[model samples]
Target: MYLGIDIGTSGVKAAVIDEQDRSVAEAAAPLAVSRPRPQWAEQRPQDWWRAVELTLDALAADSPAAMAAVKAIGLSGQMLGVTLLDRADRPLRPALLWNDGRAGAECRELERRFHDFTERVGCRPMPGFPAPKLLWLARHEPAALDRACRVLLAKDYVRLCLTGEAASDRADSSATLLMDTAGGDWDDALLAACGIARTMMPRLVDSAEIAGIVRAELAARWRLPAGTPVAGGGGDNMCAGIGVGAVRSGDAYIGLGTSGVYFVANDRFIPSRFAGMHTHRHAVAALYCQQAVVLSAGASLAWVGGLLRAPDLSSLMAEVEAAELIPAETPVFTPYLGGERTPHDDPTLTATFSGLTHETSPLALVQAVMEGVAMALADGHEALIESGARVGEVRLTGGGARSTLWARLVAAALGIPLRLQPHAQTGPALGAARLARQSVGGPLIAASGSEAIIVPVEPSLREQLLQKRALFRRHLHLSR
Candidate 1:
């Protein structure tokens, strides 16, 4: 058996899979993101470790035999987080997360400092990247910066605690705005621009390579086999790609987690310096992936649900789905709740609801929120296309993908067929397990049992949505 763990922004998940790639046990633990200040997202590094331990304990209780039979482990997590560590690998402070915008000024400063920043990093230096976070710390918290001796990404920190090693993979490291992506190494020039040094970065490794062995104490505590090799997995997006079997050129999928991502694989590294899409090494060897990210997906729905005091999103969604599909004179929503990415790349933007009337019902609000997220993803799809990604069909995955109404809306908005792959609800955890399988020289698992559903668009509805999109753009421009 192989064990895989994914440390997500909102939760930690673990799955145990057999040699045949079937999951035998699964567990998860919730996490909370603290917005201590505007545009600042923080999470305790030790909280992540505790969550992982809790998840493992749950898995052990559920399937002790599988946990004990685990031969190897793999990891995946949210990308671009900066986890500062002092000497002896202790966290200096709460991790600066990917969605945090406190480093916006730092991003602009780095852009001004480095002429070839985009070319080397494969994407614009948004506030989400780790390089800017380092610079922000250097400017705002010099004391902590001075004491910090090493930097690690979210999953890398977890790996360090697991195996007593500080290392990272190409996919996660490339997104840091500190990597020479094409060269697959930390770029000295870019590091200098951020006022960071090579020694601060973790040792780089391939995603599926064995980075370290599980420490004896950790293994014994978790009921895992001692000395099990732990694979250098990948970021959540890349691992989800592997989970869904999007390893080859032309393979694509739309992830609908807290953040929506339109991901496409490439046989070679193809970086677009001008476009907003991100190009990073695929977790699979000798391949690359391009992704267009939407900062809010299911988040919008959750926000609206809370505003209406609904118990959960499902009830609101059910009401929306059952409501009549009118001729699109409803409230228009722009889902910029956590700001925008992909084509826009604007961190200061905020969500807005326009065109609400006295006649607007709770159902209309829910529908508008769902449609807003779909429209945002459609914009992301366009951005990916502009980056030269040749998408055929989108395999939709994540919590939002489970909503039939939202899936239909996304499919109609993108004007493409979407396949709902089996076991997609597991998301990154299963992908990590798959990587663990591959790290041990297991055979590649083909994408199987996916049901493709094509939602046809109505001409009238398309025209109405187009008008709404134009209105959205105009409102966005005015808001800026």
Candidate 2:
């Protein structure tokens, strides 16, 4: 058995898979983001470790035999989070997450200093990236910056607890804006620009290579063999691509987790000229992934559900499907709850509910939120195409894949078919497990043969959606 662990924005997941690529057992534990300040998101590094322990413990308790049989472990996590550690490996402060937008000014300053910043980093420096976050700390929280001894991404911190190693995969490192994306190593100039030293970064390795061995005591506690190797896995999107067999150029997938991503695999590094599109290394060597991100996708639905006091997201979506409201009459929503990324790198943007009427119900608002996210994705799709990234049928993965109605809406919005595979929600963890298997002399798993294809909406519905999408774009422009 091979094990995969993913430290996500909302939770930590552990999955165990056998040699045949079948999932043996899985477990997950919830995590909460601390948004103490508006436009700022932080999480205690210890909380990630605690959540990892909870998930692994649950897996060991439920499948002791599989846990014991585990040959190698791999990790995947949210990308670009800044986790600073002191000399003793203790967190200097709460890690700044990818969605945090408090460093907008620092991003501009970095670009102003480095005229070719976008060319070097593969995209313009955004507030969500670690480089800008580090610059922000240097300017506003110099004490923390001065006292830091190491900088680790989200998953690497969990790896430190598991193996006592300070290492990161090249795929994750490339997104930090501190690494030379083409060279696949840390760039001293970039580090110096952010007031970071080369020694502060973790040792980098390929995603499928063994980075370290699990601590004997922790291995025993988790029912794994001593000295089990931990593979240098990758950022969640890279691993998700592996899980869904999107390793080849033109193979694309849409990740609908806490944040939404439209990922297309490439054989070479193709820097995006389109604003907010990211070009980063893939977990697979010699490959790269171009991404157009929506800062909020499933997050928008969750927000509205909480505001309306809905029982849960699934039930709320069910209510939306049952309502069958007319597209023309439904309120239009702009899902910029935490600002946006693709096409417009604006951090000051806010969500809006336009065209609301007295007769509008909670269900209408929920439906509008879903449509708004889809429209946002459509904007990303256009940007990807404009940047010369080719996308055909896209595999839909993440928590939102469970909703067929939403899938159809996204398909309609993108004007492309969406393929849904079994266990689509388990993409990242499964990809991590796949990477672990590869680390232990196994082949990359192929995409499953069984998949449900969601085609675009009918002509009439598509035309109505187009109209609503136009209105959505208009509102976003007016808001800007």
Candidate 3:
């Protein structure tokens, strides 16, 4: 058996996989993610650790045999979250989340400082990336930055807390926008451009490489055997790819989480200077993958659901899906609930529910929200293709994948088939499980599971969505 744990934004999930790559036992525990201020999201590193400990204990309690059967432990987690830790492995400040947009000025400064070395930084200038967050701390929270310690992301912090060894995986480090996506090493030139020393980084390792075992005290407290091998796991998105058998070249994953993404796996690195697409190595092996993130995807429907105060999410989607939305109407939505990541990478962008009148029903409004998100994802997909990456059929996952209407609309907007997965799990925990199996010389990919599939079914809606998408482009406005 292998243990796979996902350190997520709102929770932690631990799963024990049997020899057959099936989850024999699993447990999840939720934690609080705070948005203390607008455009600023933070979480304590301890929260993720505690969530992991509790979930692990629960899993062990449920299956005593799992304790001895576990051969290796793997991790998957939220990407781009910034955690500053001291030499003693203590957190000096709250970790900045992936969605936080407080580093705008810092990002601009970085762009100015690294005009000559932009290509070395792995990706384009984006406010939510870790480098800018580090700059933000250096400028605004200098004491915290000066505490003289390592800066790690969410999963790396969890690895440090468990093993007392600060380390990072290629997949997670890719999100920092600081990794040499092509070279597969930390770009010292980019690090220097950010004014940070090399010592500040943790030891880099492959996703499958074993980092360390559980510390004795914690292992005993969590009722686990000592010296359990903890495999280096990729960032959540990469893990998702692993979970769905997207390990080979040309395999693609279209994630519809809070943000939407069209991820394509490639054998070699592909750079897009204008498209701003991410060129990062695959967490499982030597090949690289290019991922394009839409600023807001599932977030649009979630926001609308909350506004409606719908008792159940599925009911809300169904209710909206049953309604008819006129194609001629130009209801433009930017889907910028939390700002955006791909193409524009703008924080000043605001959302709109334009082309609205008293005649627009609540259900129609909901349909419009889903359509808007689909259009945004299509925009990212097109930009990436324009940047010269070969586009292929998209495999879908995440909460938004549950909506048949949304998936078909997105498919039509992108004019590609959107096939679903066996399980619609977007959690990195599953990804970690897939990685754990791969590390031990199990199956090289995760294609033989109880996977599900969703194909496009609505052409009329697709045509309407395509037209609305064009109108949305015409109306897109950015203040900065």
Candidate 2 Cα RMSD (Å)? 1.2
User: lDDT values of the candidates?
Assistant: 0.83, 0.89, 0.76
Q: Tens digit of lDDT per residue, candidate 3, span 137-234?
A: 87788888888578888988888888888888877897787777666678787676665678999888889888878898877765567777788899
- Put down candidate 2 lDDT per residue, 1-480, tens digits, no spaces: 999999999999988988777889999999998989889999999999999999999988899999999999999999999998998999999999999999999988988999888778788899899999999999999999999999999999999999999999999899999988998889899999999999999999999999999998999898999899999999999999888888888899998889889999988778875579999999987898899999999889889999998877988888788878767767999888888998789887899999989988888888888888888999999999889887765888889878777887888888777888566767899999999988888886844546545555666666778999879988886556
Off by over 4 Å in 3: 221-223, 322-330, 446-450, 478-480
Model 1: weakest 10-residue lDDT segment is: 446-455
Q: List the residue pairs that clash in candidate 1.
A: none
Give the winner by lDDT: 2
State the displacement of the C-alpha of residue 122, model 1, in Å, after optimal TM-score superposition. Answer: 0.6
Kindly list the per-residue Cα lDDT of model 1 for residues 49-101, writing each as its tens digit: 99998999898788889989998899999998989899888998999998888
Question: How would the candidate models be sorted by lDDT, starting from the highest?
Answer: 2, 1, 3
Better of 2 and 3 by TM-score: 2
Cα lDDT over the full model 2: 0.89
